[model samples]
Structures are given as structure tokens and as C-alpha cells.
Target: METFLKLFENPSVLKFTKLGLWILLIVLIIGFLRKLLKKRIEDTSVRYKAQKGVEIIGYFLIILMIFMAITLDDIKDYTIIIGLFTAGITFTLQELILSIAGSFYIFFVRVYKPGDRIEINNIKGDVIDIDSIYTTLMEMGEWVSSDNYSGRIVKISNAFVFKGPIKNYSMDFPFVWDELNILVTYDSDITLAKDLILAEANELLSEYSQKSKTKWQEMVERYYIENATIEPTIAVNLTDNWIALNLRYITDYKLRRDTRNKLFSNIEKTIRSTKGKVTLASTTLQLLKIPELEVQLKNKL
Candidate 1:
């Protein structure tokens, strides 16, 4: 009993006990706040931000406790030394530090959020998660057409946002402009082919175009942007062996493949129904005249 009482009376023992209690209290408070915020906030993004804020506060509190315990009475004398040491360590881990900074930038600036389809450094994918140092993506567009997923998950360092362009496909504008070209033999009816393609594109993408216009108007109001045509358009160009009918339209970023498939199916049906009037073009090799040098080579032999 005496020994135990003496142990409690020791200044170091009492300081450590106090520090532990403070840490426990801080943790409990942070946990309680986190639970309360989660219950109150229904939005996933807002909830994520609240949780992150609570975590940062908890970290600061823990660090303060450690600092207080270490400094005790000589805080002024140790401050400069600790600051210099921290600076040196930060310099050594600059990339990691930058990644963390990028994460904060992404969160505050809304560069890209979860469920946003984005491309960074030529890697296109749908963002699945974002942490302090990395952004997780369900990868798309490698060995897959029309931005479809490649069935791979990629973890990219958040620092890449500072290194290269970040293309957010579904940010403020959830639509992207895409075009498809149909080739027909020059002998086919050029005007008829153009008309058919335009009709098909308008039929398939009309609703998408209308929705895109509404969203685009919202974007224009929010940001500095020029008004663009949101309706399907057609362009015709004559190639050496074929006439190219290009159909351009807007579509939801995530539904590019499905949209393309529907457009192609409709166009195919229209062309097939047209019979010979819209015959697809194909390359052919013809013998202009058998090589005249054949007989001369045989005589030399």
C-alpha cells in the first residue's frame, strides 16, 4: 500500500496518467462527434468530410498531448529544434507530403469526387475512393472500347493532380460529345446516305441531347463557357474511295458504349433497309495490266 501510494505521488507517474486520461477523453469525444455527424448528415460526401475533419482534430489533440508531455517546462528551448527537425523530415518525404496536400486540395476545391469519371496521366477510370495519399479508380478504356471498364482497380497517387491534367468527365458537365463516321461507296446516293445517318442519330440521341443542353445551360451559368449546339449534327466528306458521313452528338459520359451501340444498330438497320442506295464501301485490288517485265525476265534467264 505504501509503495503504491508513493508511485502515485511521483510527478512523472502522475503526468503520464493524466496524459493517458486526456487521450482517452479526446478519443471518446471524437468518436461521439463522428457518430453524431454520421447520423445527422445523409449525404455521403458531406459525411466523409465531417469524418475527416474529426480525424484531423483528433490527430492534433494527440500531438498536443505528446508535445505537452515532452516539453513540460522547456517548451521555448525545444520549439526551434523540433521545428527544424520536422522541416527536414518533411523535405525527405516531399512526394508523400504533396500527395496529402493534393488530397486536401481535391476535397476543398472539388476537383473530382467519388463516382466522377476522370482521366489523369492518360489513365481513364471511375473514381471509387479518395484517401489522404491516393485515389482509387475502377479502370476503364484499356483494351476496351468506348470508355468501358477493363475490370481492373487502380490506385493512383494524388500528387498526379499537380503533375498533369485531370480530365473529369462527369464533373459539372456529365455529358461528352462523341462522333461516329459511316463510309459508303461513292456510287451510292451521297445525299441519301447523309440524310439517313442524320435521321438515325437524331432518333437515337435526341433525348440525350435535350438533357445535355439543360445541364450545359447550368454549367454556363456557373462557369465561363460558350454556348454550344447540343443537337445532333451531320457532316459529309468525300474520301478517295468512299463518302464519310460523320454524326456528332452528346451523351452521358458513363453510357458512351451503350449509346454508340444503339446509334450503330439504328444506322445499320437504316442502311440495310436502303438496299443498294447506301452500300458500304470496301477496298479492292484490281490488276491494271499484268506486269510487262515478265517476258523480259524470262529471256534474261
Candidate 2:
């Protein structure tokens, strides 16, 4: 029993003992903070500012602990030993280091912060929080129709920002251009139909186009972005079944579902009011009598 106690008293062992104790203390403190963290963050929307506080505090604690361990004369040699370990850590855990770098990029670059909806790769969601190892997302737009949530939580490595295209839906010039295709009968009066559809789209899209244009111009002045033409219009494609009118126009990104519904409803109404100038296209069935039908009639006679 005395030998075991003496072994633990060794300086090298003591350094490890202190590190474990400090890490354990950090875990407990973090656990307690986690309980109150959600409620506190909900009251304020400055997630970036709040997370900056967390990052600073967490790193401070880690550094202090490391400093204390290094102060031990018995363990000063181990500090040199740790340098050798760093190269191995850098190689083996390179992905994790990149994730940490990504976290810093997210903070300093002011990219998509918590609560903003973003798409990294094909996964789309509202970002719930940014943790040390992974970013949390309220997973959406998979298995569910439209852009609705699947009621699942996803944690993606932050390094994905560099690996794939980062789509920030709520960033500067947050509106998106959604297209709906409507087909009217080919024989329909193309001019009148175009006018009615154009009228509906202009009324529906003009407001958002103006808003997006103003916002985009502000961004252009702040950054070197190419000038954009802020107009909402429809393009027509003539096809066998109908004249395909693609309503390509700007709309609030999050309100895509609602915008689509309004566009479709008004289109239906416009078609009705057009005095038979337009009709929704559909295939008609035509049947001809078979050779057997005439022979059967003659036989009956």
C-alpha cells in the first residue's frame, strides 16, 4: 500500500493527476453552465457576442490549468515532452484542428452565426448553436416535402464550410428567386394569356424586388459586388402540350412556401377571368373503332 502511494507521489504522475483533476473540474462547471445557458441565450439574440464570451472563458480556463501544471519543477521536463506530442496531435487530429480554425473563422469573419438558416453541402437547417467540436442544426428539408423540418438534430463538422459551398439564406440580399411553370393550351391566345400572367406576377413580385434591390445596393457599396438588375418578369417556353410560362422572380427566402401558394392561387384566378383566352393544358383521349368491331356488326346482320 505504501509503494502504491509512493508511486502516485512521483512528479510525472502528479502532473497527470493535476490535469485530470482540472479537466474534471471544467466538465462539472460546464455542465452547470449548460443548464442555464439556453434560457439566458433565448432572452438575447446576439448569439455571436454570447459565443465569443464562451470561447474566451473556456480557453482561459484551459490555459490557466496548463500554466499551473508547467510551474511544477518536477513536471517542467514534461512540457518539452508535450511539444513532441503536438506534432503527432497536429497530424492525427488535423481535421479537428481545422474544425477549430473554422470555428474561429465563423467568429471573426462573422459568417452565418447561430439561429441563422444555412446550407452546408446538401443539409439545410437553422443553426441552433456552435459547440467546440461540431455545429448543431435543426435538420430541415429532407424526407419532408418542401423546406420543412424533419424534426431531427444534426451535428456537422465545421470544416464542411471549406469542403462545400456555404449558402447563407438570411445574409445580405436574403431573397431567393423561385420559379413556377404553368402550361396553357397551345391554341390559347398567347398574347392575352401572357398579359394576364404578367399582371399576376408583377403584382405579386414587385414589392419584394424593390426591397431586395435596395438591400443589394447597400451591400454593393459596402463590398465589390457586380451591379444587379432588380426586375421581376416571366419567360415563356413553347412546348408541345402548352406554352410553358416560367415565373422567375424574387421572394423572401424563408417565405418560399407562402409565395408559391399565392402565385399559384392568383394564377388559377387569372386563368378563370381571362374570358377563355387561356386554359390550363391537359391531354385529351381520342379512340377509334377496332377492325373487329365492323366485322362483328356485319356478322350480326
Candidate 3:
């Protein structure tokens, strides 16, 4: 390594060292700000936001320092070479670049921040951490299905932010409007069927809706947002052989399955009370013509 030794003997190495010192100073400043911010802030969210700002600034400083180090003396002459080298890397390390860019996009757009439950591409879970190239999720869809965390860890590339359908569960409008469609035979009393579905949804979802509404209203006031009319409603549609009873309501994204369980149990119990009167629609085949023909032939004989 005579070449390596010779490189350090030059003045450019000293310049690189100076830039490193500058970066180290920036780190100390960021650390000081964090300590200062911690003393006055009680909100975890605010502390996290402050920490994130520090981290982003540190990244920029480090990158800039490295770039400055590359621009000294003999190294300064190789700027074009570095450009070409970076271009080559862009083509070869496409996924890495896309992932990095994706992270930036997610951060700036505030698509789904940390602690938000999300379904990205098909994996559903709460976002636990956001790194430069990947987002870590507390894995879901195992024991408790339907977008709830199942106590596992998953790391997905940030590139998925651009390529896949992203579902955010902790947004301003975090509650989701969900429904359970129950169809009954035509012989069922239409009014009774409708009442059953509506009563089940209301009994189970009423408390949650009220609590969510109050919380959302407080958030709206704090954030100075426009008030929205938030109410849960059920609907009914009909066909010849069946009546479609849809129990629609807003629910916590992670608890859609739980809500469904309550709604289904109530609906099942009510429908059971009307046994034989209200039953699920099923396929039926009738041979009326053959029976009538057989009776006529016997009569004629």
C-alpha cells in the first residue's frame, strides 16, 4: 500500500479531516438541540418529530462533508470520474436508489408515518420503524386476521411506496366504513330482516362511534380542520330470492374483524328467533311440469 500511504501524505487528507471535524460539530449541535427539546416537551409525538428533524439534518451534513472531502487536491481532479462512477451505480443499484428515494417521498409526503397501521402491497401491519431503504412492520394477518398485527416482524422495501397500493389506518380520518352483508330468503319478513341488521350494527358499533367521534372532534379543533359529519348507517337491498342486509359502520382499522364478529353474532341470534321465517338464500330446483304431467296421465288412464 505505497499508493495509499502517498495519498495521505498530501495536503488533501488534511482538508478531509477538517470536513470530518465540521460534521462532528454538527452532530454535537444536534445532540444539544435534542436535549433542549426533551426538557420542555411531554408529548411523545412532538419528541419524535424533533428527533426526526435532527436525524435528517445529520444525514445532509454527513453527505455534504463526504462530498467536500472528495473535492480536495488530487481528489478534486477526479470529480468527473466520480460522476461517472455514481452514474454506473445508479444503473447497477437501481433498487437501492429507488428505495432511498421512496423513503424520502414517504417522509416528505407524510403518506403514513411511524406508528400508523398500514397495508402495503398485501402485507398489513403497524409501521414500527422507517429506515433509508426499508420500512419495518409489526407483522399482521396471522392469528387475528383482517389488518391486525399478529406479533411478528417484517421488513419491506420502501420502494413499495411507489409501486403498490398503500393503505393508511392512522390518518386524520382513521376510522373505516365497513359492512357485513347478510342475505335472507324471499319468504323472510322484509321489515324484520332490515331491523335485525340495523339493530345489531347499532348495538355493537354505537359506543365505538361515539368515542371515535369525540376524539376526532378534539383532534379537528386542535389542528384547525373542517368538521365532518360522522355517523354510522346501515342499508338494505332486495332480490326475488333474497334480501341483502348490509350492516355498515365505522370501526378501528385494526378491529374490523372484532366488529364483524359482534355484528355476525347479533344478526345470527336475531335471525334464529325467526327460524323457518328467515333463512339464508339457497339454490332450488323445481320440476312442476313433470309432476303435473304425471297426474294428468294417471287421470286419463
TM-score (all chains, Cα) for each model: 0.77, 0.81, 0.69
List ranges where model 2 is wrong by over 4 Å: 4-27, 30-52, 63-80, 91-94, 293-301
Pairs that clash in candidate 2: none
* Best candidate according to lDDT: 1
- What's the true lDDT of residue 238 in model 3? 75
* TM accuracy, model 2: 0.81
lDDT of each: 0.86, 0.80, 0.79
Error of 3 at 103 (Å): 2.9
* Cα misplacement distance, residue 186 of candidate 2 (Å): 2.8
The best-first sequence of candidates by lDDT reads 1, 2, 3
User: Could you give the candidate ranking by TM-score, starting with the highest?
Assistant: 2, 1, 3
- Per-residue accuracy of model 1 over 60-151 as CA lDDT, tens digit each: 77878878786775557658877997799789999998887788789789999889999998898999888778999999978987677899
Root-mean-square deviation of each candidate, in angstroms? Answer: 5.3, 4.1, 7.0
Clashing pairs in 1: none
What tens digits encode model 2's per-residue C-alpha lDDT throughout 1-301? 9998998988678777879888788767765665557567765555446655666577568767877776755555566777778788889999998887788778678788887889987899989888666889998887898778899999999888778788898887788878888888887887887778777878888888889989988988999889876666678898776789887778888889898999889988989887787888877778987775444435554
Stretches of candidate 3 above 4 Å error? 1-4, 12-54, 67-76, 92-94, 142-145, 148-151, 210-241, 274-301
Model 3, residue 143: distance off in Å is 9.0
